[model samples]
Target: MAAVRDSSFERQAPEADAEELARRHLVQPWPYAGSIGSEARGLIGSGDGIYVTDGEGRRLIDGPAGMWCVNAGHRREELAGVMYEQAMRLSYNTPWYTMNEPSAVLAERIAAHAPGDLSHVFFTTGGSSAVESALRFMQFYNNVRGWPEKKLLLSRGGAYHGSTYLSASLNGRPRDRDWMDVADGLVVKLSSPDPFRRPEGMTVEAFADQLVDEFAETVARIGADKIGAFVGEPVQASGGVIVPPPGYLPRIREICRDNDILYVSDEVVTGFGRLGEIFASQDVFGIDPDIITFAKGVTSGYFPLGGMLVSERLLADLRRSNHPDAMYAHGLTYTSHPVGCAVALANLDLLEGGILDHARAVAPYFQERLKTLEELPLVGEVRGVGLMACVECVADRESNDPLKLDYEVGKRIDAHCHSLGLLVRPLIHMCVMSPPLIISRSQIDDMVAILREGISRTMDDLATEGVWQG
Candidate 1:
């Protein structure tokens, strides 16, 4: 395939000067103290389809799909056109007292795709705020019901909710909270349902049973009356794309329902065709959550927008509450922005048109292709569902223990893959691959081929450096 370029995105400054400026001025997310404001990442010049050209003019596959949000692919004219037209018609509207037509329409459209009675939407700036809104709403709901003490949240070991205070508190990745402080008293963590890390010699079904029992035991010990909600990713996106064992989510949902604890599915990564569905709660997992927080692919990352879909039953309960005059008291300045909603509408059209069908048809092949990487000695496992997957490296095949070198293995693989024309999201010892849903079978082959070579080269480097032998 020929390289596609967008002249409109031409760099204003030379590559060397641009890097220098960024190192001096820009503060990137997840910065380390050693290089906090003095670092510059690879410069991506422009993107089209599943490919992006870096500042060095190397065309590479967008392996992580712009942090797993660019589902409709890069440089989509439909999404771009809608944003421009919407901005021209009505760019900014304060959603506090007033509202806009696009938000209402988008909400209605989203509600149609949502499960159960999730008929209402509360827009936010992004995934972090979306989750923040859901958690805060849970607090307000309990308070309004005269149970202010019932505010403890339940999260899992391998989850990634968001970056806001409360939401970040729920993050379960190893390093996410090492240097950060969270509301420790307000959250309860459960075991990660990662079948890969399940106890040795245990069947997957037994592992699932163990997980469910743990939840039940935790609830019984802590008293369900004190719990407000249980938030989890259907697939645990950043947690190495951890797909729980079969029948786990439905059982957990039932437990949440029986205990009157709300189940909040954070679909920031799984929603919008990444899992071959608009919402994976009911359609894919056979569970209807009380609230579903989503962002990322809603507008294909064209604009920053996210929101939570609330069940009608929850809203009705609030309506019937004695505190009829109570206010939830949560809102963002950019809540229900007209342009974001309009872009989302167009993005929905693209998905419903045929992109969703394409994603569904190609997902199995995508998974199968990536799974082949497990043949490599460095790969401990390659597991995922739909188009999302993870390649986890281990020190040895027997124990599946990670390299003591921390995330260096993943970074080395990413470095090699970047040179081989593919971008990769290195999450510590794992390399996550959630390419754009628009990727073709040929593209998947290319991606996996490059990845295999990258990992092989990384193994070679490790052996040369006396890190490990296979």
Candidate 2:
């Protein structure tokens, strides 16, 4: 006998109709001014493991892993079950006056895994809020300490913190601030630590020295007394997976410590086993930050949850401050949502069960396989740490001029890959690949194979159209 379909389920509209409805009503993120309110992205029907079925029933590998989350993969029964159970037991609770058990338990677990004296957690709704909270806390801490003038934030080029007003002001990508407005007076920019983009003939070590020198010089020129915090991602994710030079992060941490500036590690993409560790600041980079902001992978994208771990030293200082009545005046309605925390706890169990170790075991292979793509003429460089990598296409490899290449190269490659059964996250002239941590070796091979062919086809198309010669 065949399995029976549930008749009680509500009927759904056709895929094309759904897409049309979205085009008429939805306003997607990162939209252009011309198409801001009328854009319909490709519709995804469902997902299982590292694969998602598209609207037309094509099974494509989730290369970007749902915006660098979904560490445990898709259709996770454990995560889904816990969300249902928690919602049924206690769906919603006001965190302003009350408390929840799961949030407390999750905080304790996270603190145990955190580095240094980071023993406190402040939960938020997502990554942007987590970053916003950290920055606000920095300001509040300074104010309570009677250093109101120390309000400037230091951010490097290629950095991406969040979308909130204060946090978005710290973004340094060229296009991020072109047409948008931010609190410009609050931020000071620094050079990006991209080794591949270093000055011609500069050694990676020398480039590292220049970056550190620039930071020290900037602090000296601007005076550390006026600076509040320096926020950075462990690995620049959206800026094309720019893994900084050796000793770069630790040296920066030391400078922050010496100057009394808060070092905010925006581990929104690197935390929760993206780099084969619970947190990469201390374990991988040998630095203890004043605060660590995290999101994306915390709950494996099973739910919207993000937070930060503040150092015990900072809290102790705040407690010992003269103003005992001053409030932080920061929080969200879903500060400690029980259902989200429950899903996070279950996701944590899944990671510790073996997925993290699996990522560690296969990271070397992942990097090595991706590096092979550099042999392609259109490929300029492929760089990343752990499971995250970027494939940068360039028109002239000798000069490494990505600007000379067609800006739509990444999108073209993505379109071809989508047809060949792989979804890619195109970032201008680069394509980012960060498959689920649970992806197998065979799946990695399949992903790389499809990417290789897609890129080759893109090259062929460009050549035929007289865009660029191979």
The best candidate in terms of lDDT? 1
Candidate 1 local lDDT, 67-149, one digit each (tens): 89999999988888788788778999888789999999999999999999999999998999999999999999999999999
Cα misplacement distance, residue 345 of candidate 1 (Å):
0.2
lDDT of 1: 0.94
Model 2, 1-470: lDDT tens per residue? 12222354357667998888878998999899999878888999889999999989999999999999989999987888788788878998999899999999999999999999999999998999999999999999999999999999999999898888988899888799898899999999999999999999999999999999999999999999999999999899999999999999999999999999999999999999899998999988888999999989999998999999999999999999999999999999999899999898988998999999999999999999989999899999999989999999999989999946588799999999999999999998999999999988889999999999999999999999897987
Q: How close is candidate 2 to the true structure, as a TM-score?
A: 0.98
Which ranges in model 2 have alpha carbons more than 4 Å from their true place?
1-11
Question: For each candidate, C-alpha RMSD in Å?
Answer: 2.6, 2.4
Q: Model 1 segments beyond 4 Å from truth? A: 1-11
Determine the backbone clash count of candidate 1. 0
CA lDDT, every model vs. true structure: 0.94, 0.93
Candidate 1 lDDT at 367 equals 94
Q: Score candidate 2 by lDDT.
A: 0.93
